[model samples]
Each structure stands twice: as structure tokens, then as C-alpha cells.
Target: MNFSEHFLHFIWKFRLYKTLDLFCVAGEQLRILNPGISNTDAGPDFNQAKLSIGGTYWIGDVEIHLKSSDWLVHGHQQDPAYDAVILHVVHEHDQPIYRKDGSQIPVLVLKNLYPEHLLDHYHQLVNSIHKFPCEKQIGEIEAVVVNGFLSRMMVERLEQKSALVLDKLSRLTGDWESAFYCFMAKSFGFKVNEIPFELLASALPLQVLRKHLDHPLQVEALVFGQAGFLSGSFKDEYPRKLKKEYAFLKKKYGLKPIGVGAWRFLRMRPQNFPTLRLAQFSALVLKSDRLFSKILEIEELSDLIKLLAELPVNPYWIKHYHFQKETKEVKLQLGISSVHHLIINAICLFLFSYGKYADQPQLISRAIKFLELIPPENNTIIGWYKSSGLIVESAFFSQAVLQLNKYYCAQKKCLNCGIGIKILNK
Candidate 1:
């Protein structure tokens, strides 16, 4: 039986070899005496595991290989991570290896203990046209039970996002609403521009934004300056004026400029440019004083959606970013799709970050239902999940994939994973 990356992760997570005796690549008896730190930052490579070989028991660390020959095959002798490894575990034992310090690293072949049924399932799903590793028998697994699994998945999802929340919250002087504003802006930028938006947030501090509450020009300066737009020279007097204003504000706020390319507009319609987005985004932030607090108070989805229905774009931004020769009113409203996506993502992060003990059942349930009310996400992660059979074709399937990946694959907490437990029992 050949091993895969998933199998390696499975071993680290489940310690699946505990029930059987181990063997070196030479077919000699090997034994596992310990499983070490699973979350160590810097150690003898992959999370430490201890084992004994022959009568000479050793305890340094453990590393994985597809075949025993991988020791020499991958040049493990050169990697510092493998130097302290006492035992090398592989699916097919084919060769021996030595440490950089010249100690022999014992090899243990794992196929003897791995069940054929499991291997069959793996081969069947992987070889098929279906996307998921277990797509063929997914229906055989109880849907009722799967929903329960989703409950756990949702819980996990929120915990993951909540950590990010706390990190940003810490930087926001522990102000949840302020952190939410930053979070929302970054999410709007999406993966293509996450780092840029983060830099944008840092460049334009909340204090700077708050000071400009009543003035559109101040809002423009804050957004453009933070986004690194006001750095360059524009031929127009208006942009020049904004740049001058930004310089004073930057010094007063001790702003370190971000490296965001001005929010794009070349290929986009005039409405999609950095200029318009900044104007629209600024208006929303200025109007909403306590964003997180207001969101928590919202009792219905419609009520929350109502918050995004208006255009925050300043009057001058209606037709012109710099000068107005032509008059046209472009109402800068939040796209409903964008708002729903952001709220769902935020709620997922909040619940997942806490893991199993936090017990936020109602919030997770509401979040899922809210996601169901919306359309499937149209992004890479969601697209990949859909392609892999992790989600069915439906509005809520995207959230289900998000939920499942968090609780199952990403966390490696598979014993708690509904699908993992089901497959194991099978």
C-alpha cells in the first residue's frame, strides 16, 4: 500500500499505529514508546514522536516518508529537521538512512497495520471522476448526522476567524467596532488585496478617520493617503490639494504610509476605480459610529442588510474623482452580495476561533441559516471545495464547505470530524 500526504497527516493526528508493533525498513522489530509535542514551533522537525528500535530504545523525534528509501531519496541527511529523528516511518521500507551526526535512523513500515478497506476506499474515490476522497459513499453516511457535523464545523469555523478578530481587536485598543471596520474593509478587498488593505488600515488610523467624520475631503484624504494614492503627483489641482492635506494629516497622526497600489481602475468602469471605492467606503465608515455594536444588536438579516443599502460616495465622487465637468449621480451602494459574504465570513471566524469548548450553538446556527439565505460564494476556496464534492450545488453549500474544512481537514482534529469518524467505523 502506497501512502499519501493525507495519510501522513492521518497518522500524526490519530497515532494510528499505536495498536501494532513497528518494524524498520529491514523488517526488524521496532516499537513506538512516545508521541511528542504536536504543536512545537522549533524542534527536530515535524512534531516530535519517540520510539524504540531493537533493545536500543531511542527518543529524539519522528518523521514521515512515503517509502523507506525516502530517507536517501529526499536527502534527509541534509535537512536539520531530520537530524534528531530517532525513527523514520514509511509505507514501503526500501532503504536505511543516517543522521547528520552519523546516528542510524530506524525505519518503520506502516502498511501492515493500515486496513485494506480504508485503502480500497481511498483508491476508489481518488481514481473516480468525483471530486472528494469519499464522494462515492457520501450519501451512505447519514445526512442527519452530517448536519450535526456541520454544527461542529460551524463552531470550528468561528473559532478560526475569532483569533484574527482578537488580533486586530488588540491593535484597535480593544475596540470591537473599530476592528470590525478594518475587518470589513479588508474582506471587501478579498484575497487579491488582503495585505494591501491591512496596510491601508495601519496607514489610516481610526483616530484620523474619526476626526474627518463630517467632511468628504478629509475622508478622501484618509482613504487615498492610507492606500498610498496621495504619494504620487497628479496633474489635477484637486488631487494635488488632497495630497497636500494628506501630508499634514500624516504628520499629525504619525502615519507610516502603506504600500497599497491605488485601488485599481484601469480596466474597470470609472465606478470601479480606487477613487470611487475609497469615497464610498469612507462615507460608510463615517456614518457608522459603532459598527460591531450595531451588528450585534441586529435581530434579523434584513435589518443587517439595511445597513449596506445606501451609497456613501461623496457628492463630488458622483461623476468625477478629480474635477467635475460632467454631472452624473452614481449612488455608491454596497452590493448586497458583498455584504452577505462579509457577514457570513465574520460570523464563521467568530465561532471557529473558540474551538469545542466555547459552545456558541445559537450564533452558529443563525449564521448558517443566514448563509443559506444567500448565494454560493464565487471565490477560489469555495470553487475548489465545490469542485471536490465537499459541497453540493446550493446557496448554503459554500458555507458547509467552509465549515467542514475547518473542523475536518485544516484542523486535523479528525476524530471529532463526522466524516472521519464514519469512515473509521466503516
Candidate 2:
């Protein structure tokens, strides 16, 4: 049977093969006291293993391959890293292997010891054309197992998002406030104009905006101007005022705006237009005094929501979604759903990142607690997981499902998934 090295890894990791009695191809009895921890980096496949071969106890690393000759194929003979290897585990012992000192290495063959059904089930799941590898068998898993795995996946997702935040913080010389500002701007763009919003934030730093925060119009002018919307002629008086204000501010700050073409409005609702988002973002900047500090003090979900809620947008945006276009009058405040999105994507990510870097476990606990308080996001990808019999009632679960879908299901990494492991083990 043809199988991937990953499949072989699974067999070795779980000791899926029979273990009553084992022997090496060199005619010596073998007993595994411990298979050791699996290594993901360079060198050995498993590290710090303990074994008894021919009544001699040994403790070192174990290297695995499809065949014994693969040891030489991988060029391990001359490398010093492999010198500590105490055993060679192979599916087929086609040839002998030796250490750099020219001493023979003991080999164990596992071609027949493992159950064939396990391989069959693994192949069936990975080779399937379904949306998820174990979509069909997922229903059979107990809720406890499913929830446990999702809980893990949720934390993994948070860690992954936190990594981006931490990277930004590092680049800013550990400036948490600036990192939060950039990420918050990106979240305001809501995926469509994310890149442009990020660029706008970079061009106009938080310190520059902070100086003008006492004057709401100047704050709006800086954000709008840096976004590339303040340039060119406008038919409306509001934009003309902003254009004049921006011209002075741009020269004062020596700022260069991103290209106007970076913003996208195609297939987007008027309320969600980039212009409206920038307007709301400007209002948020003015209202959110020491925003990162305020976020750090927030304990309750309601307080966090209140902090991000119902900013008094400028009167100019009350009847307009663009610079020169007028539409029906609309309340220009963030919706509850949009606020929840900000909490999930920006607030939680920063909290988690800060907790990890600053060594505050309480902050991390609060970050996760905030997710539990929010409702699940309504998106097509989430709806599909709900249809698959998965409970996705909170952003916590929804984030987990998104992570599982993107990292495990989409990539067909069933062997590394808890759900897949449960299905295959059964």
C-alpha cells in the first residue's frame, strides 16, 4: 500500500502497531520502553526515546523512514546531529545503515505489525472530496471530543492572530499603543479595504493624530487626507473644507497619502463604503482617548462594547457615503455586529498578544472571556460548519471552526486533526 511519510508518522506516534513482541532485522530482540517525544524540527524524528535491544538498555533519539536506505538518502551519515540516534525505525529494511563512526545501527521493520484498517481509514478521509476530511464521520464523535478539539483550535486561532499583533509590536519597538492603532484601522476596513486602511495608519502615525484629537475636524482631516480621499476637486462644501484643512495639515506633517485607487467600493453597501468607514474611523480616533490604555482596563464585555459603541460621527456623513454623493440620511455609528467584529478581531487579538508578552495571565483570561460573551459571526463559511452538525453558537466556536476549516480541512491535514485522529482510532 502506498502511503505518505505523514501517515507513517501517525502510526509511530500512537504506537498503532502490535507491541507484544518485536525484533530487529539484525536478529536481536527489541522492547520499546518509551517511544519518546515527536520532534518537528531538523535532526531526529523522535527525541529522547528509551529502548532495550538484546537485553541492553538504551536512551537516545529515533529516526524513521520508509526504508533503511533512506537514512543515507537523507544524508544523515555525515551529519553530527544524527550521531545521537540510538535506533532506526523503518517500514522496510531494504539496506543496512551505519553511524559516522562506522558502527551498525539497529533497525526495526513495521510493515506488518500495524493494523491495515487504520491505514485504510486514514486514506479514505484524506482522499475524500468532501468539504472536510471527516465531515461524514464527525457526527459519530462525542460532543465532548468535538468541543474539546474545537476549544484547542480556538486557542490556536487566537495565538495565530496574536502572532501578527506581536510582530507589529516588535517592529514598533514594543509600542502596544501604535500596534493597536494599526490593527484597529485594518479592522475598520472589514477585509475589503484592509490593506489601504493599514497603509493610511502607517502614513499618519497615532502621535500625529493624537496632537489633533482635541479638534475633531483636524482628526477627520488627517485620517481622511492620509487615506487619499482629501485630494482632487469636490462638489460638496464639507469635502472642500476637509481638502483645505488637509492641504495645510499634510504640509505641516510632511505626509504623503496612499494612491486614491487603493480604495475599493465595488459590490459593497453604501453604508459600508470606504468613505463612510474612514469617517467612522476618524470619529473613533477622536473619541477613543488613550484607546489602548482604556482597552487594558476594561473587564466586562459590556464596558468594552460601550467603549467602542455609538461614536458621534461628523454631521457631514449623515446624508452621504462618499465625498460628493448624497444618499438618504442614515445614523453614522457602528452597528452592534460591527462592534462585535472589532472585539473579536482587534481587541481580543491585542489582549492576547499583550498578555503573552507582558506575562499577565489575567489579561489572557479576560480576552477569552470577551469572546464567550459575543455572538457568533454570520458568514457563509460558518453556516457551512453549522450545517455539518458542529455547534457554532459563539465567536469562540466560530473562530475555532474557521481555523479548523482553513488549517485542517482546506489543507487536508486530517492526520494532525483531533477529530480525524478520533475517527481513525475508532
Candidate 3:
């Protein structure tokens, strides 16, 4: 079975390789004092390693490869980054390697050093065709271990989202409110039209919208106009008025509308149309003042749910999903599931990002607690985890499982995953 370089890194980092009676290619006795830190960035695989070669202490970095020739294949022989690599660990020692300073690096072949069973287990995992490589054995793991892993994965998920939020904040020049608006708008579009909504938010800043918050119609006009929805002529009085209002606002703000093709409507439910989503968003903007600040003050999950749920879209949307398209009159209120999604993906992430930016730990704690209070999401990914004997109690675990499946399992980063490590060690 073909194995990745990460597999070798995993064995050496965990000391799964045979430690006793180890020797270098030059017949020198080798003993590991410390394996050192694993570097994910450039240069050495492991840095600041401590090892004793022939009873003499050596302090430097450690480089690992499938073969000794790979060192030269990767151009580390000429690069100064490998000059500090005191030991070259490989599965097969095919050639000798020298540092840039013309000094020889010690080679240790690990092909026969580690247990064959460990390699067999890893091969089965990486080479498997199942949805999860270890799906068959996942149920055998202890509940406490699984729970601990999920908890850590949840934080990992949060950090991954936080990176996006921080990047947006940086681009907005620390404008947290604008960043929040962009995230919220994206969530409003859900997955189908998220990009177009984000583009709309970026084109029309919250500062410009605040000037017309007193008039919900003008707010709707601004959003719908910037989204390129009001560009076409409409027979309906409400849309015609919005078109006129948007014409004035567009010229006043010097706003440029995104491409009309950006918003998608094919195969989408009527309620999820970009037009309805913009209407609902306009309602939210009208109802709330300093929306991000208000979100930061919300501690209870019920309050947040009610806050998002009670938003009323423009009356015209009550009977129409789009301009001049009449549907049966119904409450155009945001659905419970949609609200929950916004709270999970948008509000919670914003709160966590705010806490990080403002150095407020309580806000961070509240954000996590808020996730725990929400119900687990029902989706194909979460369904897969449940079928695999993983019990998802709340949104926290579900989010963690989602992150694990998408980032770790799908990418085949088994050696880096806790569940994969457990299976390999077992």
C-alpha cells in the first residue's frame, strides 16, 4: 500500500519507531533525547530536536522522507534551511545527503524499525473506500475519548471561521460592524446565493444604509437595487416605487450594482429566492440599530432566536416572492431553521470574533454556550456521523463533526486526526 510522508512523520513524532538498539547508517548508536516540535511551515519537519549520536549529544532539526534521495530531490541539499538538519530519517536509505556547508547528515532507515502491524492499520485506513476510512471501527472507541475529540474539533471549527472573520475585519480596517453585516448577509443567502449576497453587502456598506433605516422601503430599495434586482422595469406599484427610490439612492451614493446574473433562482424554493432574502434582510436592518453591538449583548439563546424570528419583511413580500410574481399571501417571516442557521454560522461567529478583537473572554464563553443551547443541525453530513455510531447532542458536536468530515476525513489527513490516531495505535 502506498503511504504518505505524514505517516512517517507520525511514527517518528510518536516514537512508534523502534527505539532500543537503534543505529545510524554509519554504524553509530543513536538515542533520542527529544523528538522536538513539529513544524507545519517551511524548512525542517521537526525543529530543535535533541539526539545522542555515538553517545555525543547533537542539537538540531530533523528531516524525514520516504528515501534518502528525496532530500536532494526536494532541493534541501542546496538550501540553507536544511543546514541545521542533524539527522535525515527515511524509510529507505538509497543515497547519502550533505548539507549546504558540505557537512554529511546522518541517515536512519525506519522501514524495519516500526511495528508492521501499525503500518498495516494505517494502510487500511488511508486506502479504504468508505465515507470515513475508520467507519467500521469507530463504534469501538470509548465514549469519553470521542467526546473529548469532538469538543476539541468544535474549537478548531470556530478558529477556522474566526480566521475568515478576522481577515474580513482587516480588509474593512477594523470595521467590525461592516464585517458583521457582510457575514450576516452571506448567511441570509444560505448556500445557494451566498456569494451574490456577500458581493451586494460589500458594494453597499452599512454606513450608507443607516441613513435610511427610518424608512424600511428605502432600505429594501438600497439592498434590492445594489443586488441588481431593481434594474428591470416592474408593473407592480411596490417594485416600481422601489425602482424609483433606488435610482435616487444609487446616484446619491454613487453605488454600482453587481451583475444581475450573480443572483441565482434556478431549482430554488420560492421562499429562498434572492428577492425574498433581500426583503427579509431589509426587515432585519430596519428593526435593529447597531446590530453587531446588540448581538454582543445577547446572552440567552431564546432571546437571540426571538430577536431574529420576529423580524417582519416588507408587506409586499407577504404575497409576492419576487417582483410582479404573486404567490398566495403568507407570512414572509424567516423560518426557524433559517434563523438557527444564521445564529450558528453568522451571529455566533461574529460574537466569537468580537470577543477575540476586544479581548473579552466572557463574550467568547457566551458564544460557545450559545452553540450548546441550540439543537443539532440535520444534514447529510451529520446523518453520516450518526450512522457511524457518533452521538451528536447539540450544534457544538454537529459543527465539530462537520468540520472533521470536511477538513480531516475528506482531505485524508488521518494521521493528524484523533480518531485516526486512535485506530492506528490500537
CA lDDT for candidate 1: 0.63
Global local distance difference test of model 3: 0.89
TM-score per prediction, in order, is 0.64, 0.97, 0.96
lDDT string for model 1 (264-366, tens) is 5455555555566666677777778666666655657787777766756656666674343333555566577767766666643443332222475665555
Single out the weakest 10-residue window by summed lDDT for candidate 2. 1-10
| Clash pairs (backbone) in predicted model 3 | none
CA error at residue 73 for candidate 2, angstroms: 1.6
Off by over 4 Å in 2: none
The number of clashing residue pairs in each candidate reads 17, 0, 0
Distance from true position, residue 192, model 2, in Å?
1.1
What digit string (tens of lDDT, one per residue) describes model 2 on residues 231-323?
789988888888889999999989999998999999987888999889889988999878999999989999888877768688888888888
Q: Rank the candidates by TM-score, best first.
A: 2, 3, 1
Q: How far is 373's C-alpha from truth in model 3 (Å)?
A: 1.1
**Which prediction has the highest lDDT against the true structure?**
3
Task: Specify the highest-TM-score model's number.
Answer: 2
